[model samples]
Target chain A: MSALLAVDGISKSFRGLKAASAVSFELDAGAILGLIGPNGAGKTTVFNMIAGVFPPDEGRVRMDGRDITGKRPDQICRAGIGRTFQIVKPFGGLTVRENVIVGALASCKTVADAEREADRVLDLLGLADKARQPAHALTLPDRKCLEVARALATRPKLLLLDEVMAGLRPTETDRMVAIFRQLNRESGLTILLIEHVMRAVMALAQRIVVLNTGEVIATGTPEEIAADQKVRDCYLGEEAA
Target chain B: MAMGRATRMLIGLMVALLLAPFIGNDYLVSVLILCLFNAYLAQAWNIMMGFAGQLSLGHALYVGLGAYAGGALFFHYGTPPWIGMIVGAAIAALVGGVIGFLGFRFGVKGVYFALLTIAFAEFTRILFDHFTWVGGSSGLYLPVVRADHDNLLLLRGRPAMFYYVILGLSAAVFLICHRILGSRLGYYWRAIREDQDAAQALGIDTFKAKMAAVMLSAALTAVGGVFYAFYTNTLYAESAFAMHRSIELILGAIIGGMGTLFGPILGAFLLTLLGELLTRLAENFGHGFEGVKQIGYGLILLVIIALRREGVWPRLAKRLGLDGEKAS
Candidate 1:
C-alpha cells in the first residue's frame, strides 16, 4: 500500500533563514518514524508545517493519498492528524478532564458526545485520578503525558510527538516508550516523533530520518541510520554511532 | 460528569433570579438593575478578554456607540427606543468587527491591542462630540415622562419594565455564554487564548474565531448600552466611553473569577453596592467628597488581587464546584 503519509519536497523559510529546505519523507500505518536533528536544524519547523501551524513555502504533504498541505490546523487535525507541542500548552483554567475536553470537543460532532469521549480518554491515560486537576499544576512528566493524552483524546490516526520525551527521567521515558510502542501495536496509530534522545527513539522508532541544516541527511531503519558515516558526522559523533 | 457543584450554582442562579424582586427594596432593586447591566457588560467583555485573550481597554466604546445610535434614532426620527436599541447594537457590532479584522490580521497583542482599543474609543468619542445631530458636547437627553404612566410603547415608562428587561437579558447572556464556553467554539476560543500558534496548528481558524467573538461581545454589550440609554434617558461621549467604565467591567470579571459564568454577576453586585455605600457615606459626611470612591475601588482591587489572584469567587467556588475551580 502507499505510504500512509508523504511529505513531498517541503520547504519553509523564516526571515531568509532556511528552516527546512526540500525535505521529504513518508510514514506508513502503524509505523514509528523518528526525526532527529541538531538545535535550530528546523525539526520543530518541519513538525509545525506538517501539523498545519504554517504552510510550507514549497511542496505538498499528503495523507492517505490526499493532499493536505497548507490546510487549516484544525481541519488537518480532524482529518486524523494529531500533534503534541514541543513545549506543552494546556488550559490553566480547565481541569485535566476539561483540558482533554477541549480536544474531545475539537474532534466530536457534539458537546455531549465529546464529553463522553473525554471521560473515556481521562481514564485510559491513567490520569483519572488527576482528571480534576488544573493543567498548569502538573509536574513536567505528567504535563508531557497530558499533552499526549490531549492529542490522543482527538482519536487521531497519526500522532506527531515533538520532544515529548525531552524532560522526562529515564524511567519515565522507558515507560512512555512502552506506551508509545503499545499505541502503535494495538491502536494502529501512526507516529512521527522528533527527538534528540537516542535511547527513547531507538526504543520506539522502527525507522529514523536524520536531518542537518534543514535538509534530510539520512533515512533508514534505526540501526542502519545509526551506522551511516554521514549520519554520524551530522548527528552522532563517530563514537555515538 | 456527575451531578456536581457547578450545576448547583446554576440552579442557585435560577432561584436567585426568581426571588430577587420579592426580596429587594426599591433602592436595592435599582442597585440590582445596575448590577444586571454590569453583569451583562462583564460577560460580553469576558468573551473577548477572558476567552479569546484579547485585552480591550475601551470596550466602553461599544456601549457608548450603542447608546448613541439607538438614542439618537429615537430623539431624531420619532422611532421607538426599542427599535433604536437594535440599531445601536448593530453599529457596535460593526465597529467591533472592523477592529477585530484590523487587530487580528495585523497580529496585534497584549498592551498594543489594548492601546488600539483605547484609541478607537477616543476617536469615536471625538466624532460624536462634534456631531451636533446627536446633541454634540451638550449631551443628549430624552423628555422626562409623567410618573407611573407606564408607556410600554416608548419602552420608557417604568423601572420594573427596565428591571425585568435587564434581568432577562443578564440571564440570557449568562446561559448563552455558558453554552458557548462549553462547546467546540469555546475550545477554539480557549485554544486561541492560551496558545494561538498551537491552535492554528490544530486547524482552528483563529482569526475568524476572534472576529466572531469580538462582534458577538460588542453587540451584546451594546444591548446593555441600549438599556442604559433608555433607562436613564441621557448620553454623553465622555461618560459613555470612559476609560473607567472599561476598567470597571474588566475589574468586575477579574474580581469575580474570570472564565466562570457567575463571576461577573457577583463582581457587579459587590462593586455597585460598595460604590453605593461609599457614595452614601460621602453624602452624609458633607460636600467635596473628592476621590474616595476611586480610592475605595483601588483598595478593593488590590485586596482581591493579593488575596486571590485568579479571583475571589473562583477559588471559593472551586472548593465545591468544577466550573471555576483551578485544575489539579
Candidate 2:
C-alpha cells in the first residue's frame, strides 16, 4: 500500500547553518510515527517545511499522492495537514472552543458547524470542561492539549505534533499517550510526532525515526531503534551519559 | 428567552437619542449631532483596528476622500448628495484597498503599518492642497440654497434634520458592526487579531480578511464624509485630512473598549459630552481659556487609561450584569 505522507529528501538551510538536510520519512495510513532527535536536530524545521511555514530548500512533500510542496500554510491546512507548534499558539483572547472553532472553520461550512466540531474535538481532548474559559487562562499543559484539540478540529489526514509532551509530568504524558492511542486506534488517524519524552514516544509510536545533526540516523521499530549501535552512539548514548 | 439587560438598555438609549432634537435648542441639537458623527466615524474606524487588529492612524484620509468626492461632485456637477455618497464610498474603498494591498502584500505590520497609513494620509493631504480644480488649499464650499422647504433628499435644511440623519446613521453602523462581530468572518478576524501565524495555520486567509476590514471601514467613513460635507456645507483639506482628525477618529474606540459592540458609541458620547461640558464650564467661569478643554480632556483620558486598560465598556457591562459569553 502507498504511504499517506511522503517526505522525500527534504533539506533546509538558514543563513550559513543547515537546519535539516536530505531528511526523509514515510508515514503510512493509520500509523503513528515518532520523530526523535537531540536538541537542534531540526525536527521542528521538518514540521515547518511539511506544514508549509516555509518551503524546503530541496525535495518534494506529497500527501495522499498529491504534490503539496511550497504551498502556503493555509492552503496546506485545507489540503488536510494539521500541525501543532513546539511553543503553543493558542488564540489567547478567544475561548477554548473558539480557538478550536477557528481550525474547524477551515473544513466546516459555517460557524454553527465549526462550533459543533469544536465541541466534539474539545470533548475528545478532555478540554470540554474548560471550553468556555479564555485560552490565556489555561495552564501550560492544557494549552498544549488545546493545540492538539485545535489541530484535530481541522480533521487532518496527517497530524504533525511538535514537542507537546515537553514539560508534561510522566502521568500527564501517559494520559496524552492514551489519548493519541485512542485517536489512532478508533479513527485510524495518522500521526507524526516530535517528542522528547521517551516514555510517551515508546507508548504511542508504531515506528520510530531518529534524527541527528539534520540527517536521519536511524529508522526502525522502537526495539530496533533502541538496539541500533549508530543511534546509540549519536543520540541514545549521549542521553545515557 | 428573556431579553438581556444590555439589549434593554440599548433600546432605551436609542429611544432617548431619537427624541433628543425635540427636547433641545439648536445649539444642544448640534452638539448631539456632533456626538453622533463621532460615534459613526469611530464605529467605521473600529472595524480595521478593533476587529481585525490592523491599526490605521490615517482614517482621516478616507473621511477627506469621501468629503472631497461628494463635495466636488455636488459643486461641479450639481449631483444630489445621495449619489455623491455612493461614489465617495467607492473612491474611498479603492484607495483603502490599495493601502491594504501595499501593507499586507509587503508584510508591513504593527507600528510600520501605522506609519504607512499616516504617510498615505499626509501625502494625500498635500496632493489635495495643490489640486486647484477642487479649490486647492483654500477649501471647497457647497452652496447654501435658500430653499424655504427642508430637502431631505439633498441632505440640507435644519439642525434637527441633521440630528436625525446622523442618529439613524450611527444606529445603522452599530447594527452592522454587531452583525459582523457575530459571524464566521468576525471569528476569523478575531483569530487573526489574536495571532496571525496561528490563524494562517488554521487555514484563515489573514490578508483577505484584513483587506475586507480596511475597505469596509474606508467605505463607511466615506459615507460619513458625504454627510459631513452636506451638513456643514464646506470641506477643507487641512481640517478633514489632518493628523489630529485621524487621532480623533480612533479615540472613542480605544477609550470605550475596542472590539466590544457598544464600546465606540459609548466612548464617542463620553468624549463629545466631556469636551462640550468642559468648554461650557470654562466659558461660564469667564476664563475663556484656549486650551483648558483640551488639557481637561487629556487628563481624563490618562485617568481612563490608567484605571481601566481594557476600556470602560467591559467593566460597565459586568457591573450591569450584561456580560455575555461571546467577546462582543
Candidate 3:
C-alpha cells in the first residue's frame, strides 16, 4: 500500500543554524513509527514541518499522494492530520470535555454531536471521570491524555504525538503504550511519535527510526534497532554505557 | 439546576430593567440610562479583549469613528440617526478589519498590539482636533430640540426615550454576546486565548478568528457611539477619542470579570452607581473635593484588582449558583 504520509528530503534552517537537513521518512497506514533521537536532534522540527508549522526550505510533504507542503496548520489538519504539542496546551479554563469538543467540532454538525464525540474520546482515553473538571486542574499524565483525546476527536487518519509520555510515571507510561497498541490495532490509526522513553517506544512502535543532528541514522524493527552499530555508537550506546 | 438559576437570574434582570423607567424620577432614570450605555460599550469591548484575548487599550478609536461618522451625516446631509448608526458601524468595522489585518498579518500581538490600537486612536484624535469641517477642537453639537416634546424618530432630547433605547440596545448586545459565547466561534476564541500556537496545531485559524472578533467588537462599539452622540447631544475629539475613554470602557469589563457574559454589565452598573454617589458627596463637601470622586474610583479599582483578581461577577455568579464554567 502507498505510504499514508511521505516526507521527501525536507530541509529547514533558522537564521544561522540548520535545524533540520534532508530529513526524510515514510509512515504507512496503521503503523506506529517511533522517532528517537538525542536532545536537539531536530525531531520536533521534522514534526513541525510535516504539520505545516512552517514551509520546508527544500523538498515536499505528501499525504496519501497529495502534496500538503506549506499549507496552513488548520488546512493540514482538515486534510487529515492532527497533532499535539510537546508542551501540553489544554484550554486551561475550559472543561476537559470542552477542550475535546473543540476538536470534534471540526467534524461535527452541532455542539451536541461534538459533545457526544468528545465524551467517547474522553472515555477511551480513561479521562471520563475528569470530563467536567477544568483542564488546568489535571495531573501531568491526565494532561497528556487530554492532549491525545483532543487530537483523536478530530478523527484524523494520522496523528502526530509529541512527547506524550515525557513526564509520565512508569505505570502511566505502560498504560499509554497499551493505549497506543490498541489504537493501532483496533482503529488502524497511523501514529508518528517523538519520545525520549526508550522502553515505551520499544514496546509500542513496531518500527524505529533513530535520528542524530537532523539526519536519520537507522531505520528498522525495534529489535534490529537495538543491535544496529551506528545507533548504538551514536544514540543508544550512551544510554547503555 | 445551574441552568435554572442562570435563567432565573436573567429573567429577574430583564424585569428590573424593563420597569426602571416607570419609577418617575428623571435623574434616576438618566443615571440608569448612562449605566446601561456604559454596560453596552463594555460588552462590545469584552468580545474582543475578554473572549478573544486581544487587548485593545484604544477602543475609543471605534467609538470616536462611529460618533464622527453618524454625527457628521446628521449635521450635514440631514440623514436620520438610524441610517447614520448603521453607516457608522460599518465604517468602524472596516477600520477594525484593516487594523486587525495589519496587526495579525504582521504578527503584532499582546502589548505591542495594544500600543498599535492606542496609536491609531491618538492619531485619529489629533486629526479630528484639527479638521475644521466637523467643528474641529471646538466640537460638534446636534440641534437641540425641545426636551418636553419627545421625538423618537429623530431621537431628540428626552430622558425616557433615551433610557428605553439604551435599554433595548443593551439587551440586544447581551443576547448577541451570549449567543457567541455558546457557539463554535466562542470555542475557537477561548482556545486561541488559551494558547495560539496550540490552537493552530488543533486546526484553528487563529488569525481569522481574532480578526472576526476585532471587527465585531468595533462594529458594536460604533453603535454605542452613535447612541452617545444622540443621547448626550454633543461630541468633542478630546472626550470622544481620549485614551481615558477607552480605559473607562474596559474598567467595567475588568472589574466585573473579563471573560464572563454578565460581568461587564454588573461592573458597569456598580461603578457608575459608585461614581455618581462619590460625585454627589464631593459636591456636598464643597469646591476643593472635586477630585475625590476620581480618587474613590482609583481606590475601588485597586481594591478589586488586589482582592479578587477574577472580578466581582464570577464570585457573585457562583454564590447565586449561576456560574457554569470557570471564568477565563
Candidate 4:
C-alpha cells in the first residue's frame, strides 16, 4: 500500500527534556492506524507538530509528495490536514451549527457556501437536531461528537483524532465507532485514532503503533501486537487477547 | 413569532427616529445624535472586541487618530471634508494594522493586550501635543462659519448639518457591521475569540483574521473621529486621545450589550442621558460639585457589571422581542 503521509525522524526537545526522540511512522491511504501511548508520552505533541501548532525542532512531515513542516496551521489546513483537540473547545457563546460553520468556512471564500456545507456535515453527524442549541448547553458525549463534526466539516484528506473515546461509555463508544467505520466505508477516509480504549482500537485499527516515552515501542497488526512482548510490556501485562 | 416580533420593533423604532428631527427640540435632537454616534463607535469596537475577543482598552486611539487625520487635511490642504473623511479613515486603518500586527505576532494576551492599546493612545496623545502643526495641545480648529451658514459642502458648520451627517455615518457603519457579523469572517472571529490555540490547531490563522477585523474597525472609527473633531471644532489632546474616552467607548458597548447590533447606541443614549440629568438635578437641588456626575457614572458602571455583566441590551432585546438573528 502507498503511504499517504510520512513522518521521518521527527524530534522535539523542551529545554533538557526530550518530548519526542526520533519518532518515525507512515500512514497508508484508506487505512485506520491506532496510536497508543501512556499519559504524557508525546502522543498529542506529535499530533500538534503534524497539524502545525508548532514546527518540529528537527525533521520533516510530508503529505503525498509535498513538504509541510513548519508551515502555518491555516496553510496546512487548506492543504487538507484537519485535527481535533484533546480538550473540546467549541465556541462557547455560539450555537452548535455556528461552531461547525467555523470549520466549513476555514477553506471557503464565501459565507453562503460555508453555511450550506456546515448544515450538510451537521445533518450527516445527526447534530442537525441540536443545531440551534448553544454549545455550552451540550453534554460531554455530544460535545465530543461536535468536535468530530467540526473537523469533518473541514473536509480533510486525513483526520487526526486525539482521545475522542477517553470519557465515553461502552455504548457511546460503540455508536461512535460505528459512525466512524461508516464514514471510512462510505467515503474512503484515512483515520489516525489516538485512543486509550483498547477494545475500540483493536476492533477498528487495521494496524496499531504503541508509543512509550515518546518512542515507538511496537508496531504491527492488532493480533500481532496483542501477542508481542513490547506491546505487553507497555500495557503492563493486560493482553488484548 | 420571533421574526415577526423583531419586524414590528424595527418599524416602531423607524417611526420614532424619523419624527424626532422634525418635531423634537434641539436638546433632544443633540442627545439622539450623540446616542447614534456612540452606537456607531460601539459597532466598530464590537468587530474587534466582541467578535475577535481582543479586549482592547484604548479604542480612543482610533477615534483620536481618525479625528486628526481628517480634520488636519480640511484645515490646511484645502481638501474637501468628504475626501478628507476617507483619508482619516485610511490613516486609522493603517495605524490599526500596525497595532494588530505587533500585538498578534508578539502574542499579547488578556490584560496585557489592553495595556498595549492604552500605551499606543498615550503615545499618540504625547506626539500630537508636541506636533504644533496640527494645533498641538491648543487643539485643531476648523475655519469658523465656513464662508456661510448654508454651505452645503460636506464640512459645513451647523448643528443640524452635523447631526444629519453623523446620523448618516452611523447608519452606514451599522449596515456594514450588520453584513460582517453574518459573514464567514464573523465565524472565524468568534472561533478565534473562543480559543486562539484551539483555533490555530483547527487550521485558522488567528493573526490574519484578527488583523483584518482591527483594520476594518479602525477605518470606520476614524470616520467617526473626523466628524467629532469637526462638529466640536476642536481636538484637545487629553480629551481626544484620553484613556478614559476609550474606556467610555467600551462601556457603551458593554452596557448596551457587548455583541448585539444596537447595544452601543442604547449604551451611549443611556449614559449620556444619565450625565445630563445628573447635571440638571444638581443645579435644580443647589448641590453643586463639578465631579459628582463622574463619580455617579463610575458607580453605575460598577453596579451594572456587578449585576448584569452580559449587558443591558441583550436583556432589553429579549424583553423587546428581538431574539438572536439566525443565519439564513
Candidate 5:
C-alpha cells in the first residue's frame, strides 16, 4: 500500500536563507512518528509546507499517492490533513464550543452536525465543562488542548501537532501522551508531531526523525536513534553518548 | 410552549411598533420612520463590519449608487419602484464585488481596506456630480405625483404608509441577519473576524467568505437606498455619497453593540431619538448652535466608549435577564 503521507525532497528558502533543504520523510497509515530537532532546525517550516501554508520551492508532497503540492490550506485540510500552530490560536471572542464548531464545519454538512462533532471532540479533550467559557479565558494548558480539540473536529486522517506539549507540566505532558496513544491505537490515526520535549517524544513516538540545520540527520526507532553516534554528537547531547 | 424572555420582549416591541402610527401624532410617526430607516441601514452595515470583521467606512457609495439606479429607472422609464429596487441592488452588488475582489485578492486589509472603500465612494461621488444624465450636481428630483401619493405599489405614499413600509423592511432585514448568523457561513464569518490566519488554517476560505459579506451588505444597503430615493423624492450625489453619510450608517451598529443581533436596531433608535431631543432642547433654550446635533453625538459616543466598549445592547440585555442565550 502507498504511504499515507510522503514528503519527497521538499525545499524552502526565505530570501537567501534556507529554512528547509531537501527534507524528505514518509509516514505510513496508523503510525505515530515524532520529528525532533534543535531550534532553527526548520521543523515548523516542514510542517508549513505539508499543511499548505506555502508551497515549497522544489519537490512534491503526496497524500495517499496523490500530488497535493501547492494546494490551498483549506483544500489540503479537506484532503484529510489537520494541523495546529506553534503559538495556540483560539478564536478568543468565541466560546470553546464555538471555536471547535468552526473546525467541525469543515467536515460536517450542517451547523447542527458541526455542533454535535464539536461537543464530541470537546468531550474527548476533557473540555466539556468549559465549553461555554470564552476561549480567551482558558489556561495555557487548556488552550493547548483546545487547539487539539479544534483540529480533531476536522476529522483528519493525518494530524500534525507542533509543540503541543511545550510549557506543560510533566503530568500534563503524560496526559497528552496517553490521549495520543489511545487515539493512535483505537482509531488508527496517523500522526506527525514536532516536539522539543524529549521525554514525551520518547514515550509516545514509535519512530523518530532527527533534523539539524534544515537536513535530516538521522531516522530510526527510538532505541536505534538513542544509540546513534551522530545523533548523540549533534542533538541528544553528551548524555546520550 | 416555554418562550424565552428575549422572544417575548421582541414580540412586544414589534406589536407596539405596528400600532404606533394609529396612536401617535404624525410628527412622532415621521421620527419613528426615520429611526426604522436607519435601523435597516445599520443592520445592512452590521453584516459587513460586525459578522465579517470588514470595516466599510464608505458604505454611502452603495447607498448613492442604489438610490440613483432605482430612482432614475422609476422617473425616466416609468418603471415600478419594486423592480427598480432589484435593479439597483444588482448594480450595488456588482460594484461591491469589484471592490471586494480587488481588495481581498491583493491582500488589502484592516484600515487599508477601509481607505479603499472611502476612495471608491469619493470617486463615485465625483463621477456622479458631472453625470448630467442623472441631473449632475444639481440633484435628481422625482415627480410629485399627488394622485399616486397613497399608492404603495409605486412607492409614492403618505408618511404613515412610509412608516409601515420601513417598519416591515427593518424587521425583515433583522430576521435575515439573525438567520445568517446561525448558518454555516455565519460561523465562518465569526471565525474570520477573530483571526484571519487561524481561520484559514482551520480550512475556511477567508476570501470567499469576506467577498460574500461585502456583496451581501452592498446589495442590502442599495435596497435601503431605493427606499431613501422614493421617500425623499430627491437625490443629491453630495449628500448620498458623502463621508458623513457613510459614518452615519455605521454609528448605530457601533453604538448598539457590534457583532450582536439586536445591537444595531437599539443603537439606531437611541441615536435618532437623542439627536431629535438635543435639537428641541437647543431651540427651547435659545442656544441652538449650528452643530448642536454633531456635538451631542460626539459626547454620547465618548460616554458609551468609556463605559461600555462592547456597546449598549449587551448590557441592557443582561439587565433584562436575557443573556442566557447571547447572540453574537
Candidate 6:
C-alpha cells in the first residue's frame, strides 16, 4: 500500500541557524510513527513545516499523493492535516465545547452541525462533563485532552501530535497510550507523534524515527531502535548519562 | 431561560430608545442624539477591536474620511445626504481595506498594528488640514437650514429629526451587531481575537476574517461620521480625525464591556449621560470646572479597570440572569 503522508527532503532555516535540514519520512495508513529527539532537535519544527506553520526552505510535503507544500495552516488543515501545539493552544475565553466546535466548523456547514460533532468528540475524550467550563480553567491533562479533541473534531486523515504526554503523570500517560492504541486500531487514524517519553513511544509507535540536530538519525521498529548504536550515542546515551 | 431573558432585555431597551424623543425638550433631545451617536460609533469600533482583537487607536481616520466624503459631496454637488452617506461609507471601507491589507498581509500585529492606524489617521489629518477643496484648516460647514423647515431628504437642521434619524441608526446598528455576533464570522473573529495562530491552525483564515472586521467597522463608523457632519453642520480635521475622538469611540466599549453585544451601547449611554450631568453641575458651579468632564472620565476608567475589569454589562447581565454562554 502507498504511504498516506510523505515528507520528502524538507529543510528549514531561521536566520543563520538550521532548524530542520533535509528531513524525510513516510507513514502508511493506520501506522503510528514516533519522532524522538533531544531538546531543539527540530522535531516540532518538522511538524510545523508539515502543518504549514511555515514553508520549508526546500522540500515537499505530500498527503494522499497531493502536494501540500507552502499552503496556509488553515488550508493545510482543511486539506486533512490536524495538529496540536507542544504548548497547548486553547481558546482560553471559550468553553471546552466551543474550542472543539471551532475545529468542527471547518467541516460543518452550520453551527448546529459543528456543535453536535464537537459534543461527540468531547464525549469520546471523556470531557463531556467539562464542556461548559472555560478552557483556561482546565487542568493540564484535561487541557491536553481538549487539544486532542479539538484536532480530532476536524476529522483529519492524518494527525500530528506534538508532545502530548509532556506534562502527564505515568498513569495519565499510560491511559493516553491506551486511547491512542484504540484510535489507531479501531478508527484507522494515522498518527505522527513527537514524544519525549520513551516508554510511551516504545509502547505505542509501530515505527520510530529518531532525529538529532534537525536530521533523521535512525528509523526502525521499537526493538531495533533500542538496539541502534548511533541513536544511543546521539540521544539515548545522553539521556541515560 | 438565559436566551429569553436576554431577548426581553433587548426588546425593553429598544422600546425605551424609541420613546425617548417624546420627552420634547430640545436640550434633552440633543443630548439623547449625542448619546445614540456615540453608541453607534462604539458599536462600529467594537467590531474590530473587541470582536477581532485588533486594536486601532485611530479609528477616527474612518470617521473623518466618512465625514469628509459625505460633506464634500453634499456641499460641492448638491447631492442628497443619504447618497453622500452611502458613498462616504464606501470610501471609508476602501481605506480600511487598504490599511488592513497592508497590515495583515505584511504581518503587522498587536501594538505595532495600532501604531499603524494612528500613523494613518495622523497623516490624513495633516493632509486634510491643507487640502483646499474641503476647506483646509478653517473647516467645512453644511448649509444652515432653519430647524422648522424639516427637510428629511437633505437631513436638514431639526433636533427631533436628527434625534429620530440617529435613534434609527443606533437600533439598526444594534441589530446588525447582534446578527453578526451570532453568525459563523463572529465565531471566527472571536477565535482570531483569542489566538490568531490557533485560529489559523483550526482552519480559520485569520487574515480575511480580521480584514472583514476592519472593513465592516470602517464602513459603519463612516455612516456615523456622515450623521455627525449633517447634524452638527460642521467638520474639522482636528476634531473629526482627532486621537481623542478615537479614544472616545473606544472608551464606551471598554467601560460598558468589551466583546459583549450590549456593552458598547450601555457604556455609551452611561458615559454620555454622565458627561451631560457633570456639564450641568459645572454650569451651576460657575467656574474652574472646565476640564471636570475629562477628569471624571479618567477617574471612571480607572475605577472600572481596578474594580470590575470585565466592565459593567457582563456583571449586569449575570445579575439579571441574561448572561448567555456565548462569548459575545
True contacts kept of each: 0.51, 0.88, 0.75, 0.75, 0.75, 0.76
lDDT of 2 by residue, A26-128 (tens): 9999999999988899988898999999999999999999999999999899889899998888999889988999989888998899999999998888999
Candidate 4 chain B lowest-lDDT run of ten: B319-328
Give one digit per residue, the lDDT tens place, for model 2 in B33-118.
98999999999999998989999999999999999998999899988888988999999999999999999999899999999999
lDDT on C-alpha atoms for all candidate structures: 0.84, 0.89, 0.90, 0.83, 0.92, 0.90
Worst 10 residues of 6 chain B by lDDT: B319-328
Higher-scoring candidate on TM-score, 1 or 5: 5
Collision pairs in model 3: none
- Candidate 6 CAPRI grade: high
TM score of chain A per candidate: 0.96, 0.96, 0.97, 0.95, 0.98, 0.96
Q: Report lDDT (Cα) of residue B303, candidate 2.
A: 85
Clashing pairs in 6: none
**Model 5 superposed RMSD (Cα):** 1.4
Model number with the top lDDT: 5
Tens digit per residue, CA lDDT, model 4, B1-328: 7778776776687677767778878888887777777777887898898778888888899898888887888889867767777888888889889988888899887888788888998999999988899998888888777534856475776566667787788778877877788887777788888878767766787898999988998888888898887777788878899887887788788877777777777787788788778887888878557776788779888988999998787777767666665521
| TM-score, every prediction | 0.92, 0.97, 0.97, 0.96, 0.98, 0.96
Could you tell which candidate, 1 or 3, scores higher by lDDT? 3
Over the true interface residues, superposed, what is the Cα RMSD of model 4? 1.4
Q: Comparing to the true complex, what docking class would candidate 3 get?
A: medium
Looking at model 1, residue B33 earns an lDDT score of: 85
lDDT-best of 1 and 5: 5
Look at candidate 1 and tell me the lDDT of residue B6. 63
**Residue pairs in candidate 5 whose N, alpha carbon or C atoms collide under 3 angstroms:** none
The all-Cα superposition gives candidate 4 an RMSD in Å to the true structure of 1.9
Instruction: Please provide, for model 6 over B61-141, each residue's C-alpha lDDT reduced to its tens digit, 9 standing for 90 to 100.
Output: 998998898899999998887898899889888999999999999989889999999999999999999989999999998
Least lDDT summed over 10 consecutive residues: which range in candidate 3 chain A?
A232-241
Residues A1-241 of candidate 3: C-alpha lDDT, one tens digit per residue:
8899999999889996888889888999999999998899889999999999899999999998999999999999888999998999899978998899999988788888998999999989999999989899999889999999999999999999999999999999999989988988999999999999998888888898888988888899998999888988878885642
